[model samples]
Target: MQSIPYSVTLRPKIFVFTVMGTYAALAPIAVSSVFQHLLAVPMSVLLTMVSVCIFAVAWIMQREETSFKALNRIGISMILAIALPAFLSIAASIYALTVVQSVEYVAYFQHSLLNRLINIGMFATLSLLILFFIQKDVRKVTYSLTQGYFVGLSVLVAGGVWQFLHFTIGYPMPGFETRAFVHSVSEDVLINFRLTSFTDEPSFLVPFLIDGLIIGGMLLSKKAYSLYAIPAVLVLLLSFSVSGYVNLAVIVFSATILLFARGIIPKKVGLYAIISILILGMITVLIFPQLITALFMPIIGRLDSLFDVMHHSRLYMLVFPFVWLFDYSSINALFGFGPGSYDFLARTKYLSHQGAVSGTSNNAFIDLLFEHGVFGGLVFICVFIGVFVYLWRKRKGHLYNSIALLLWIHLGLTNMYRSDFASPRFWIIVLIVIGLTELAKRNITLSDRRASSSYKKKVTT
Candidate 1:
């Protein structure tokens, strides 16, 4: 390891790790980059490697700099939070499988224990590293808002462009090919010429993209952010998924409550603002019924079909998993089922023609429950809620809180794209968000401490 004066502060190590963390958060772009050969591995795998490497290198660097260790306890906590459940499952899974039959019966170990162990060891090592580095970031108000908007919009832009080229023009980037095949014209999505560029024949990208833009819009106080809603809402309406409207309703309500609560604007302002928007919206809907119907109403029809499938005992999709969720005999319930396990089950069902197939799980909570079980679900949700509650309470008048609230909103949407973590861009933005939040907290705490100390000195003097 190279050494410089402690005064220099290993900013490079911090920066490099931060980049890697960001890469791990945004998956859409990363997946495309992987197939483009701009990167050597799948973006998903690369994200893990980057996270793992950063932790490893940062650890080495920390050992060489004693003073830095004092500040790195944050990193240690991140690692534990991420890795503990994962590694525990790895050990527990193996033990459980061995009991049912033999070590050979465990699918992950069928090839070689060394390979399985290496994966486990890597996850454990990286998770600990993250725990050491992460802390409460103290972000200034305007800066945090800017960072949130940047991140929120970055994802929207990437996903939108990718979808347009793939679905509308029939030009699929190698990574985006599956989308073309799945959303083919037979799906009934090509009704309007202006809206088809979204690449999702059924308009899945609409809600995803608009949801992000909505977050950005909420953080924006000026007309600049408000103007963004026109295109975003339009695209979302076009997605033809009925739930997109539900998503819009939820996002609007969430955003208004969040923005108003933060003193970004007064609650009375929000009420008047909502009344004005509703009145204007009604006028527009009445005058331009055809246009609105073409874009937004199309998706609403899909709701009945979706519910129809669920009603016919698609309960297996939502229910069968509970057996494993509670089964003490399986390693899944206590520690975790591990990442990608439920997808594996769903994929198997697809292959057998027993389940309706889509790459994404329809529900985020259910998806989480199936994979990580009670403990993992609790930790993940609690962390999310804790972040929100802490932001709402501790940080007054910060845009990052708006962003945090939006991310939670995204998570709250029934089906969060789990693979989101694979994107470098997404991770970078989220990393900054988290880091900024942590930094801001520390600044406030230190400021309070100094003030207290000064008062004591004055009293003594």
Candidate 2:
């Protein structure tokens, strides 16, 4: 085969590198008091700015190559899934505004609609820009993203360790500013340290650590990558996030059903997985006995907290949206009060009744259902179900397919608490997996062509 032109490859390679590097550097810094104060802007806005720059680079590099033909059925489906909700939401928001009794409620609805538009706009723009680069060279982009993902997670591990030491041993570190940064403190850092690491809160940090543990152990299959699991597991226990604990249970249960019960992943892989879990468990118990209670708290003491929404503000915040959905008018339930309407309701309706602190539905599923109504919520859910089935069918050799599938499962559960759709943790894995599936299809096509050509030559001979 002839070598591709140097100029043709060089620009795309640079674009991929830059995109991954920016994401790795900036995505995890959302909670940093230093960076937060320095930028004086939300992480979503920073990501959008970097994306715009990356998009410009992609346009220059792939202007001639870019086309609507780059999109496939799967891509079209994702676009429609996202777009349909926005339209439904806007229509619903307009209707809600007409019925709202007070001017105060109208302002709340308008603010919510604007916020939804910004989030959707940012997410859509970033996704399209990344997709454009992926279309240029799927393999290069996928490799860069995977490398960046692990690197970013490794950095988080390091940060978590530092934070643990800083709070415990009085290690001097700048910018940790607990007054501004620490969201809540239970038993104090000396007694039972909650490791926030680099992120704003413990719950925010748990999902990333979980990704490192699961994806790194099950899919990546590198010894070095697997080692990250040790510290990740350690930090996860230290974080003391109930949602994280629930997600861990979900991961274990789902893997058991997928591996042993359904026979989806191979048996050999399942054996190794069991061994890995055992080893991680032993290490956690032996070394960190003080922190070991965290592993069991979710199942033992805190299990009821999951159901007791009124006592636990986070759970209440999550369930409040659903309560609002069913209790209110059928028309309101059909198409929610509009995006961001939950916050208003939490303050006005929920607070008045329950006297709980103001909060939005931290759960994305609840948020979607409450904000967009029944039809819109179902569409969003169906899209995920479709993607899950697609990934399951395309489980080729336990690399990208396996990584994407498990990662999606993790993200799906994590979204119950972590509702920020604009976060890189949500979109980066998605776009990378999409690119990987495309590359996999291309490889299969080439292999088929080669086999066909060889058969024709054999017949001729």
Candidate 3:
């Protein structure tokens, strides 16, 4: 057999190098700033660039193959999934500038446009990742996110230690501004030794910690896990913010789905998962008696307050978002006003500049509708439906991967930014789901089935 010429061999290498280098540059850019998860910002850019590069590779390698034909529908779905949102935002931006003619409204469109672009960018990048590496080493992306956490943690620990030393020394470092905490007595609570670390406040830290929890969840192997996710579970339970608790729920639920779907989770581990969840629930009850009360009490009491206390008056102020959504022009209705425009107008008009509704739609569903309009919203719904139907069709298998996607779906339904999935926790969990889902997309390959059988054998052993 003759070896391919140096020139021909060099061509493949050149193509691969270009794809990878471009991928590296775009990964971080594609990342959206999902809340305060700083990692999201860079990861998006990296993921996007990488995705495009790999997609090119897929096109090249599969040029003479049947794999492309088999999966082309999914590819098209992915493209349309992205395009729908971008189109909606663009349409909205046009409406805001041309029809509304209001500077404040234009600002909103600007934000809306940028956000849609970022969200589209995310989907584009991920589709590419799957096309490239997943086609080669399916585990490559999974290991990156799981292992990436370890990398991020190492940084967190180092910073923590440095801060610990700074406080110990009373080091009056002037140039370097470090997170500081002070003990303050409040009227409601006793002297609280508050700790402000990094860009995160004590309150925000709850969500941050909860987000890091995928690390523990990924520890689920064939042997057993010692309810290790329990500690993180408890911390999330005791979190003051409802959002923080929700984040925790997302992590656990996703972890559970992934482990169970793969059939690698041991009986001991399953027992631990159930017990751990219940135990964490009990611990939460012990620590914060009024916690649940605080979250729901306001929502519940409103019904009585409207009828009895306020004498059946409308909750007009609270319902400003709903009213605004309807009050906008037909053009604005078809295409959202813009991003910062909504809340910015609210501040200028002095409506609401606080809470989730402060910037975007307070109601996520409505906000999605408002930004993308009906058509764009429909596109989103279709993508979700496709994702859901695709999973449901294969529900009997790939249970773990389905569960992971379910958790993402759960978060998406709740008050979450669509782009939040750009965060490290979100992306890692997503890639994990992707890895597992790919296993289910087929009629159990002999190797995968054998892996599952082997996993089961180890469990019984």
Candidate 4:
């Protein structure tokens, strides 16, 4: 068959891939180009600008049909899940002001409301535009997104390795002073003496790395990607992020079991995984003896204190919202206060006794409940379950679908330590997963049609 000549569609496809690819590539790096310190803008803001271009260029070109009806059930479900929180936040903010008549609380509530609205707006806008691009061409978007993200991750992992080497052998790296303006809190990262790479914190770097592992697993068969997994694992260890370790352990363990149960992996695969873990552990201990006390001890202490309210600040933040909820009206329990309201709630109600003026829920699950209320939070949860089930159903004997499922799982697990929804990487992964699902559906439909046509022709013959 002669190859079809390239046409006008080629330009739009190139533009879409470039914009989407650059957006994905920039997710892992947190520092912005223009500013430093107190006035520093995050790279995410720049990414948002990039997203607008995606909408503009696509709108101007009008080469392909775009409509709300183009959205699949999964896409529509996510929009609703996000919309519920924004709606509840507005309603709850109004209700909260009426109940707590303090001028101080009003100021805080307004601030929180505005920020939450922005977060919701940003998430919705990015999701919709990306969904448009995905709907335009699923295969191109899928390949570009996955490849672009892996490239960004590779750069981040390389930076982590460089940081580790500099710390270990005095190999002269750039001073933290240079990164201080870009990094959110350089002092905290400095004090930890762990590898953070280009991210603001060790924990902040974990999610991207976990996603890298997910992508690496997904593309291992398609590309020579397995080699990159080694340095990624090393960098994960070097970060000494407890949340990273915990999330990785859970994901790897659960994935291993699921794959085994499905016969995707033989019994020997389990044994091999065990051996790999032991070997990696032994190698780390031998090379980085400091991890025994620095990494493992802290992990042990944190886990041991997991239930202790005073000792575990994250746990305290997670559980304390309910304290204020119970003190307020029962209706507040159903809808909570509002988005961004947690900061004020934390100050006056949750941690007022300690004289703390600022705090965060830290846990996204708790943030959803405390800010948006139980009803809104449950809406988001239902969306997650729906996406998981859809992906899981399609995951069997499908590599990209399996990767998409794992990534969705990663998002859930990573949120245990993070609550911010406006992050570009989070949405990038979400869009990629959605694209993969849609691509798989399209391929399967075409496959069925082809088979049916063949059957009809055979019968006529």
Candidate 5:
């Protein structure tokens, strides 16, 4: 085996930790009163700055020469998966700007255009950096990534517990009073409080927990220490976010099926998994009985309301946006009315008396259609499907691949209730899976070459 250069090895660890730190800790900390008052900058801008710095560091640390041919081979599927949607989105934005003459619409479009461009560019740059690192040293890079994820999850869970304690005791942590505000203002009537931990919102926390669970589960399947999964699963349950619960259930259901089909899960591990779940359930019931009741009531209520014609249930929220988009003019259908147009219309047409519509469409696919039209929406869908199919075909036997598939299913299902595309969590998982899949393919190629060389040596002898 070839020895990796010190710098090459060190850089990837630093890069992975930085990416994990930015999302898991820094992003949330940036929103706290300490940073807000001291730095006089919003959390979003601070996150963007952090991402840019990380990207620059990764670029500067690239020692191995990346072959154009190698890049071409790795990039072809990604281009089909990402570039088409991006191009269509840009085109839609331009078209909307040119045709929509309203001053309000123009201002909104300009603001959204800048934000969307920054987010897309940042993710793209990070993805390239990840791919480069994978090409250089796949094993080291992946190990670093998984370790970072484990550390980040610990931090998030500790922070969440602290936040929950403060909420329960009615004593605010000095200099971090802002963190408690969400719990105070948005506590569900039934659930009492939703634990967001270090995240800006409960919804934000849920996705990270879900990702953590996926990683933890993968590690557990591989006979690695999986104690971290306990807190990860706990925080997810405490979140009490409907979408979060639904996604968790789906992942668990699908994983069970897969593990059974593969017959790879050991009896000991299966017993451990069951005990963990039982222990967690017992703790919840004994310590916080109301929590279970609170969690289920909303889901039950929502299901009952699904058939209620007078109520706007989650099903309606999922279906109405598409209906509205298709009803628009042909020009608007081809290219969306522009970014932020849905919120604009919601405010002006549907809820004129409710002031500004502060929420997104809550469905990423519908948001894509409303903001970038049919072309962009379709391309975006293809991007997800193409990447998933590619990974599934190439890395089928790897535990990480199963986890990635579960993550994809969770994201696809949960995105119906929330637009998570704008979140770093969504892109981070996608990029990591892509990098891992590429690494798996490269490993297979290396094995084949070694086998061929061995055969030739035997023949010559």
Candidate 6:
């Protein structure tokens, strides 16, 4: 057997464990209704500290030095893309302190400002560390992440099954007692329990499962263990989240196309697989008619609502906040209200008469506009466009880049319904995609240089 180097083994393990540990830390564990801080808060703090330490080690171990000109360009881009938005966030908070009169609002704004600063700082620090260290062995890092995700998916499926059984049997497992009875939109209509398993909510659980499906598909296409994706798909179906279903459809379609195009699966087998899936799906629906309804009725209902603007309050949620922001004074219009101020506005102004719904803007761009103002929103838009441009130019033959593009597209559509930035898992996936894309760019540049050098040497000879 071939032996692996200690550094090789150790580095990938560190990367994998750091990624897994961050996910674990961010996993929501509901304790008492009011004091649910045991795992989520403390683990998050520990993960942040560990991440900082890892960044330090990665910086010290960095070997390759990018050119000064390249570094300068990257530095300026990073400053504008990351630093500017962070500065705007802080500035908005300070401006809020000067203008806002309520103590409660001021305290909320300060807390939100602190949160944004921490989020942006962590994102920038970790991104830089990954760019510096993990870029060299991105393949290894992605493999490690795949392995970790497989384990996580397995656990989630087992727990989801157990939770479903508990729901059906009216008995809770010891030590894994039912945390909450989460219900989907379909459940609200038909009165059925949705599976959350160990996660805090179905909404949270679905995104992780969707990510698992995407990564698992990528791995499977590379001839890694693909069967693990079955359970992930199962759990996602059980979650019955409309967004989850949509994401699953997108992933399956994209993966199928990519795999067929790459000749990973023969045409005959691909056709057979599709037929088998359709037949099995029909059989499953026949066997569990109620289950099918529970899984898809909500999605259909949501789709139906898109045509009826008056009935779908989501449309209002998207437009009213921007209107309200525009109505503010020029300073507020330019810098906007501080973070969490929109939620306050939503509660006091919008939802007070609407009913018991929480005061969320529901749309990420709208929320960004409300919290960070026009300047911050513009900066964010510019950063997004930059990333998309890079991906578009470089994603031709790269599977991961294509996957990242698909994921970003999904995020864009879904963020119209809910802000993905609020989820830690969302940021983790984004960072991984960014790391992979950057590595691809670096590899391509190196290849081009080698090719040019070889051509010149041959001509001289």
RMSD of each: 7.8, 6.5, 7.6, 6.6, 7.2, 7.3
Indicate whether candidate 3 or candidate 4 has the larger TM-score: 4
Pairs that clash in candidate 4: 37-181
Among the numbered candidates, top TM-score falls to: 4
TM-score ranking from best candidate downward:
4, 2, 5, 6, 1, 3
Please, what are the lDDT tens digits per residue for candidate 5 over residues 296-403?
554444555445533443344455566666553666777676645565555443422334334475777877777777877777787667756755564346544555
Ranking of predictions according to lDDT: 4, 2, 5, 6, 1, 3
lDDT digits (tens) for residues 1-461 of candidate 1: 44666545657554644554354334333344323355564445555676677657756766643343454332333334444554665565566564545332355334433443444455555444443455312333223334434554555554555555555677665443323332212233334332322233323444345545744543444575656655555545544444555666787677667656656567787788889999999999999887765444334334454544444233345555666466545455766555434534544344223444443355555555654566766665665556557656743534444555565455456344222222233333344445545544443321224224454333212
lDDT over C-alpha atoms for residue 240 of model 1: 49
Please provide, for model 3 over 232-318, each residue's C-alpha lDDT reduced to its tens digit, 9 standing for 90 to 100. 344334323344455556656655655565666776889797999899989987798776545444233334434342232112233
Full-model lDDT for every candidate: 0.48, 0.66, 0.47, 0.69, 0.59, 0.57
| TM-score against native, each model | 0.66, 0.79, 0.61, 0.82, 0.73, 0.72
Candidate 6 runs further than 4 Å off:
1-36, 39-42, 61-82, 96-104, 169-191, 220-226, 256-316, 352-362, 438-461
Global CA lDDT computed for model 6: 0.57
Q: Supply every candidate's count of residue pairs whose N, Cα or C atoms clash at under 3 angstroms.
A: 42, 0, 23, 1, 0, 0
Worst 10 residues of 2 by lDDT: 179-188
Please write out the lDDT profile of model 2 over residues 1-461, one tens digit for every residue: 33568667676668656677567546656545556666566665676666766676757765466676676445556656666676777776777666666675677765766866776777677677667767766666666666667677778898888887787797876566442132233322323456777777777788887777764553244666556877788878777776788898888776565555334567789889889999998998999975655444433454554566666667676666666686646777787767666666655754323574454566767777877788778887898789989888866443445556777788788878875554566777677668657755665211224224454333212
Q: Which stretches of model 1 miss by more than 4 angstroms?
A: 1-28, 31-40, 47-59, 62-82, 98-105, 108-237, 241-245, 283-291, 309-316, 324-339, 347-364, 395-399, 412-430, 442-461
Cand. 3 Cα-lDDT:
0.47
lDDT of 4 at 297: 49
lDDT of 4 by residue, 1-461 (tens): 23444556577668777877777787776442322233454557656766776766775677566678877667668877867676866787688777878776687775757766776777777777777767766777777788888888888888888887887788887765322121222222222456777666677778888888877665554345567778888888767677888899988986886677556678897898899989998998899886464445434434565677865566677766767765676667788777777777655753423545345676667777777787877888888888998888877744456667888888988777864665676677788888767866675321224225454233212
Best by lDDT: 4
| Residue-by-residue lDDT tens digits, candidate 6, 137-232 | 555444444455446655666677777777678667644333344322433445355676676556656666666666555445433435566656
The total number of steric clashes, by the backbone 3 Å criterion, in model 6 comes to: 0
